[model samples]
Target: MEKNVKQIVEQVIKDVEVKNPGQSEFHQTIEEVLTSLIPVLEKNPAYVDAKILDRLVEPERQIMFRVPWVDDKGEIQVNRGFRVQFNSAIGPYKGGLRFHPSVNLSIIKFLGFEQIFKNSLTGLPIGGGKGGSDFDPKGKSDNEIMKFCQSFMTELYRHIGPNVDVPAGDIGVGGREIGYLYGQYKRIRNANDQGVLTGKGLTYGGSLARTQATGFGIIYFVEEMLKEAGKTINGQTVVISGAGNVAIYAVKKAQELGAKVVAMCDSSGYIFDEDGIDLPLVQQIKEIERKRIKEYAVRKPSAKYFEGNKGIWTVKADVVIPCATQNEIDLNDAKIIVENGTFAVGEGANMPCTNEAEQYFLEKGILLAPSKAANAGGVATSALEMTQNSMRLSWSFEEVDEKLHGIMVNIFKNTRDAAKEYGFEGNYLVGANIAGFIKVADAMMAQGIV
Candidate 1:
C-alpha cells in the first residue's frame, strides 16, 4: 500500500473508533474493511477524492427504541430495539432482524456495515441495513414471543416498508417471529404487505427455498472454492458449528454431496457421531423438540456429547464450517484446525472468526470463504421473495433453489476474479471485500454526497 493511501485509511479507522467509543465490534469491522481498501485507494484516486469512506462508515439513520411487553407470567418486561439503516445507495435497506441477548448498537452497526458489502455481492438490487433487539427469546412462551414481536414491530414498522426497508430473520428471529411481526405490521398499517418481511411461513409470503438458503449457499460457494483447488466434497470429513437453521441445512447439503459431517452443535454443547451426524435426528431435536444437541447422543447410541461448543474444533475434518456467532473461532481454534490438516473453512455466520484466527488460516494456505461472499444466499433469496411479493406470484422450491445455486456460483467467480484482477489472487477475504466494495462504492459515487 502506498504511504498516502495507507495514511488515509488509518485516519478513517481512527475517526470511526473515536466516534463510536466502546464499540469494539464496530471498530473491528471498520478496521478490517478500511485496511483492505488500501489497494483500491492507491489505484483509484476518485474514491478518496470523493470522501466515500467517510460517508460509508456513518449510517444514514439509526433507530433505538424501548420495547415493552407482557410476559406469560403476567409481568411487564422491557427490552431495547435497534435498526441501523446504514446504506441504501443501490436499492432499499435490506437485512435481517437478529433477536439475541448479545445485540447492541456496536454489534448491530458491525452487521449493518458488513451487510452493505454482502448485499452487493448477491448481484441483487438491495442495499445494507440491520436491526434486532437485545431480548433473549430462550424459555419464552409462544404468547410471550408474539407479544415481544408485536411491540418491536410497533416502532420498527414506521421506519420500514416493502420498498423502503425489509427485515428478515436472524439468530432468535425465525418463522414464528416473522409471522407475529408481520401480523402486527398488518394491524398497524392496515395493509397487506407481504413484502415487508421475508422468511415467512409457506401459507403466507415466504419463498419455498428460503429456509435452507444460507446453508445451501455456503456449500455452493465452498464447492466452487474446492473445485478451483482441484478438490471435491466427495468422501471428505466435515465438522460444523451450530445446530440452528444454518447448521442443520448445511449438514444436509454437505452429506448429500458425499461428505461425512461428523459433528454439529448448539449453544450448550456439540454432538459427535463418528459414522456421520444424523441430520433427521438433529432436525428433530433442534427444530421440532427444541432440545439441546446433547439429546442427539442420548437418542443415538453411537453419538457422543461434549460439554462445550468450542471443543468440536478438536475433531479432525477436511472442512470446518462455523455456523455459530461472531468470533467463535479464536487464534487457538485456528491453530488446532490448521494443525489437524483442515483443508478449508466456509463461514456460515457473520464474522465467525477473529482477525488473528483468520490470519493464521490464510498463513497456513487454508482455502477460506469469507462470510460476506459465502453466506449471501439467504439475503439473495430474500430479495427473490421481495420480487415474488411485488409480482404477487410464488415459485416452486426447485425453482428458488436453482436460482440460489446460480447466485452463489457467480459470487465465487466474481470474488475470485476480483482477487486475480487486483494481484491478490487466492486471498478471498481481500477479494470479497474488494469485489463487494467496488460495486457499492461505485453506486455511492454516482449518487451525490447524501
Candidate 2:
C-alpha cells in the first residue's frame, strides 16, 4: 500500500472502530473498497487529497429501526431494519433491500458500500444504497410475511422516493416482500407512485425481462469472456450455488445458452442431478414451495443431496458461479475449483468470493468476473424501469432485454478498457474499481465537498 493510502486507511479504520466497537463486517467492507482503490488513488491524486476516498468509504446516511409485527399465531415479533444510503455522487441512491435472518447493520453497510461501486460499474444514472431486516420470511405465512414487510416499509418509505432512493429485491426480500412493501408505500403516500419501487409484477408497470435480466446478463458477459478465452458455455458443465432468484435465473440462461447446469444449493444443502436440473421443477420447489434443495433429491431418487455447508466448490465442473453469499467460496474452495478444472468463475452474489479465493483465480490465470460487473444487469434494467415509470410508459420484454444486453456489453467493455488503461493487464477487479470510482469521484468533486 502507498504511504498516503495506508494513512487514509488507518484513519478511517480508527474512526470506524471507535464508533462500531468490534464490527468486523463493516471493517471488511471498508477494507475491500479501500484496498481496491489504490490504483485509482495513484491515477487521480485529487481524490485522495480531497479525502473523497474517506467520505466515499463512509455512508452519507444510515437508518436503523425496530420493526414490530404480528405473526401468524398472533404473537408480537420484532426484527431490526436498516437502510444504508452509502453514496449518491453519480445519481439517486439505488440498490436492494434484503430480508434474511443474517441481516444486520454491519451486513447492510457492507452491501451498500459494495453497491456504490456496483451501481457505478453499470454506467447508469444511479448511485448506491442497500437496506433490509433480520426478519426471516422462511416458513412464515404470507400474511405474517406481509405484515413484517409492511412494518419494515412504513419506516422506510419516508426515507425513500423514486428520485431519492429506489430499492429492489434481494435474497429473502423477493416478490412477496416487494409487493407488500410497495402496497404499504402506495397506501401511505396515497399516490400512484410506481416509480417508487422496482421488481414489480409485469402487469403492474414492471418491465419485461426484469426477472431474467441478471441471470441472462451474467451469461452474456460470460459469453463475451468465453469468446476471449477460446471457450464457450455450449456443452460446458457448470455448478451454481444458491437456488435463489439470481442462481435459478443464471441456471436457466446458462442452459439456454447451451450449458449443462449440474447443481444448485440453498441454505439447507446442495442437490446434484447428473441429468441437468429441471428448471421448472427447481422453480416449483423453490418459488412456489419454498422448500430445500434436498427436496429436489427426494423427487429424483438418483440425485444426491449433500446435507451440509461444504456441498458446493467440491463438485467438479468447467465453470462455478458462487451465487450464494459473501465469502461462501474461500481459498480452500477456490483451490478445489481450480484443481477440478474450473476455468471460469462469475460472481452472482456481491462479494461471494473471498480475497484469498480471488487471488487463487488471479494467480492461475482463470477468467474472473466480479459481481459488480457480472450481476449489474438487475440494476441497469432497474434504471430503465425508473425511466419508463417517469415517462408513463411500459416497454415490451424485448425492448428492455435489448437495452439490458447493450448495457451489459458496454459494462464489459468499460471494465476491459479500465483494466488495460490501468496497466493491470487482465485484472477486472482493479479495472471495475477504478472505472467505477472515477465516475463517482468526479461527480462528487463537481458537486463540491460536503
Clash number for each model: 0, 0
The candidate that achieves the highest lDDT relative to the unseen native structure: 1
Q: After superposition, which runs of candidate 1 have C-alpha atoms over 4 Å from their true positions? A: none
- Tell me the deviation in Å of residue 401 in model 1: 0.6
Cα error, residue 104 of model 2, in Å, equals 0.6
Give per-model TM-scores.
Answer: 0.99, 0.96
lDDT, candidates in the order shown: 0.94, 0.86
**Candidate 1, backbone clash total:** 0
Over the stretch 28-128, how does candidate 2's per-residue lDDT look in tens digits? 76766677777777767788778887688778998999999998788999999999999999888999988889888888888888888889988888999
Candidate 1 local lDDT, 1-450, one digit each (tens): 499999999999999989999999999888888898889989999999999999999999999999999997789999999999999999999999999999999999999999999999999999999999999998999999999999999999999998899999999999999999999999999999999999999898889999999999999999999999999988999999999999988998999999999999888888889999989988888899998889999999888999999999999999999999999999999999999989999999999998888889999999999999999999999999999999999999999999999999999999999999889899899999999999999999998878
lDDT at residue 368 of model 2 (Cα atoms): 93
Root-mean-square deviation of every model: 0.7, 1.6
The deviation in Å at residue 150 for candidate 1 is: 0.6
98 Cα displacement, candidate 1 (Å): 0.8
